[model samples]
Target: MVGLLLVVTLLTYIIPAGQYARDTAGNILTDDQFSYLDEQTPVSILDMLMLLMDGLIS
Candidate 1:
């Protein structure tokens, strides 16, 4: 489990994050508007660790 968590955390840094637009009904529209953000906010290692702990605890 720890190994999997570590892998996922590393992937978060390597993968380019993306976003999708939502319509009035709150449904995600993956049309032309969907795109990979050029500037991705970096997630701190501590934050990722805390998130994993929180998920396990909850």
Candidate 2:
């Protein structure tokens, strides 16, 4: 489990994060509405740890 967390943390740095657009009805937009931004905010190590904990708890 620790190893998987470590791998995911590493991937957070390597991967280009993206966001999906949502419609007024709160549904995720389709491929045509999706856009990859030029800027990617880096996820902190602490945030990653917290996210892992949250995932495990939920």
Candidate 3:
């Protein structure tokens, strides 16, 4: 029936039937954290805009 078919389709998506997807996401998150730690100084958008304006006006 339509209801049984819907249940089967939903189950297929909600199941973590593969390990590759999980491991890939974990690797990406770890890499992101490592890069964030490596950056010594981070610039804000406002600071960048101010610097650009100073360069242009001068």
Please give the CA lDDT of all the candidate structures.
Answer: 0.80, 0.77, 0.47
Ranking by TM-score: 1, 2, 3
Residue 11 alpha-carbon offset, candidate 1, angstroms: 1.0
lDDT of 3 by residue, 1-58 (tens): 5466456555654543422222455553332322222223434445555756798799
TM-score per model over all chains: 0.63, 0.57, 0.30
Instruction: Give the winner by lDDT: 1 or 3.
Output: 1
Candidate 2 structure quality by residue, lDDT tens digits, 1-58: 7787678777877888777788789876755676667987767778888987898899
Predicted candidate 1 versus true structure: per-residue lDDT over 1-58, tens digit per residue: 7788777777888898998877878876857677789898767778888987899899
Which one wins by lDDT: 1 or 2? 1
Off by over 4 Å in 2: 44-47, 50-58
Which candidate has the highest lDDT of all? 1
Model 1 TM-score relative to the real fold: 0.63
- Candidate 1 — which pairs collide? none
TM-score for candidate 2: 0.57
Error of 3 at 10 (Å): 38
